[model samples]
Target: MTAPVRTRSSEDLIRAEEPVLAHNYHPLPVVVSRAEGVWVEDVEGRRYLDLLAGYSALNFGHRHPALIAAAHEQLDRLTLTSRAFHNDRLAEFAERLAGLVGLDMVLPMNTGAEAVESGIKVARKWAYDVKGVPADRATIVVAAENFHGRTTTIVGFSTDETARAGFGPFAPGFRIVPYNDLAALEAAVDETTAAVLIEPIQGEAGVIIPDEGYLTGVRELTRRTGCLFVADEIQSGLGRTGRTLAVDHESVVPDVLLLGKALGGGIVPVSAVVANRDVLGVLGPGEHGSTFGGNPLAAAVGTAVVDLLETGEFQRRAAELGAVLRDGLTGLVGKGVVGFRSRGLWAGVDVDPALGTGREVSARLMGEGVLVKDTHGSTIRLAPPLTITEDELLNALATLGRVLERSV
Candidate 1:
């Protein structure tokens, strides 16, 4: 007879993985075994509020009923057919997602990195075919300190040394410009430029928000320069922000929108390149494809996610609760937090360095039964699930305040 699986303690499980697992990530010492809306439990049954929300991948919270139901239903019906044959669910998913983002077509992919890579390829092709850039001379301009993905091409243009240090002999045909600076972006673009790729809010750069009108300026500039404006909203889109997209705050639309993260609804890996036909039409079939990109499983879950967004409830919640978040952070400023940048439900907090490093604060928060992640040196990011209640948000904020108070 087959033996039943043995349960392991958190420490025991963590220790066991020391040898087998790669050390690419330095996660906080918490072992989450299961999760529900806004909360997760470790093996020992200790529950903590999930403040980071899987880096915005779980914007609907863990195991959302709709997303889960969609996945279960699709699993029984069909999972993948490998793009060789069409699936019933793909058309609905593509159509709904395009409508959600005000786009013409959708190129489904599997991960954030794949979406970024796909956007780059589409832009270059559009440049060559439509813009008539010389062969092999299509240049793309990117902002410094951008974090599109970890792919080789994406990292090649990254200003962060940690991501770029050992990953070179990097890709060329890319130019670097300062983010949130219109003059710098204008100087970088020329006849060879195909697209100007940027993250609406630089999530990995400590949630840096640009000044007002920056996105509008980019839209105007790209239009005038005859270059596609590709907005990488992998971390900022899908109702995590107050609107359907961060660009919506400015009422500006880019030629291409790269979306992922919460596009999967925390159930499966799903991503897409969304663009109008004029920009995305440069590619013929077989120029780019993924075996599992538009599979039935992803399509079902993604369609459900769109259904949720179309209700506009999550976006409204984020906007209303975002004020609470902003108020809480503002109160903490000069107490334990030095400063912060926030939009909707997303925030990057800079705690007083004298108290501790961001990692230290995160570990302390973990001890206090809250989960958050630290980035850079002294910055910690908070992007809780949209399903989080006001009381739960208050409790988490109070817990942060308490941790800072105790440390002080």
Candidate 2:
């Protein structure tokens, strides 16, 4: 007696799932059965190069051995402690992560949205307690086209009509200013302003890079106005952009840094809001926390992730490999690509209207054995794992070149 051989039926499975799953994600129909490093195999046993790396959450690559071992070991010892009591793994992870981010304190959470929310709370508290702002009058300036998260309050502040349309009565006190516009930012902030929340690179907005010196100028402005500068590096942080944090490219130290995504090492959800004693200390015991926020299992995985990033090995890999990927993409800039932008291992190429739509091109790439996703309308983002070998990246680039040529 033996288990029956499982015939490949991923396409059928995905089609069946179209009715059961939420419609929020308009995913391409390829059903992934397995992933290793920068490659993924469908249930049919056909492999496609993974160019998105789980939207940067797989920066350490799919199931890196160390992370898997760490997760396994933690599962054996403990899973969740509910945050009612301290867990052994939590403190060590916090201290190590604090040091890694060069921050005086760390507040752990489970998702990037939680980290952003924590930053908001900390800023508001600081505004009330330290800055002596009037109650409920504190305003946080956000950039246009920002995608913080999908939470109600987060969405309330979003500028994208698709993300915010008909969802209001939006949250009060959020001023939307233009991204990368220093003058607009300056004009928007006032004495009642609590924080300026921004992403160093707009990952969700098609890897849009800010103008040169934009981050530096924001840092200077935040410092001058006494407003807390919060960098939501959930997507651009953790070696995704070749730097430990995208702000590093401009040598700017934000008042509060929000980190998530790959910090979990592609295994568990780990997010943190890092700041000094003065900024983060605003929250006393009863004010904030999560049951699974800083639990032992997540802490364990996060610790391993910190260890991986602390070595700077992954950063170097992303930096070097990203250059190669970008170089290859440059060849498409004037061809079927209407625009192209990238930082580190991540790239966004907008297909020309003369070419097929991004969705059509993405489906075509999937057929050609390269898995990537389209963002916005005509933009496809390529974010291969940082662990991807030069040869694999080159091969993926060659595949993309073929797709671009055929798409037109």
Best by TM-score: 1
- Count steric clashes of candidate 1: 0
Q: Which runs of model 1 end up more than 4 angstroms from their true locations?
A: 1-6
Q: Model 2 reaches what TM-score against the true structure?
A: 0.97
Angstrom error of the Cα, residue 85, model 2: value is 0.4
Q: Model 1: what TM-score?
A: 0.98
The TM-score values for the models, in the order shown, are: 0.98, 0.97
Model 2, range 332-405, lDDT digits (tens) per residue?
Answer: 77777777898999888888867777888899899889888887888899888899999988888788778778
Clashes of each: 0, 0
Model 2 lDDT, full chain set? 0.88
Q: Over the stretch 66-172, how does candidate 1's per-residue lDDT look in tens digits?
A: 99998999999999998999989999999999999999999999999999999999999999999999999999999999999999998999999999999889989
lDDT of candidate 1 at residue 304, scale 0 to 100:
99
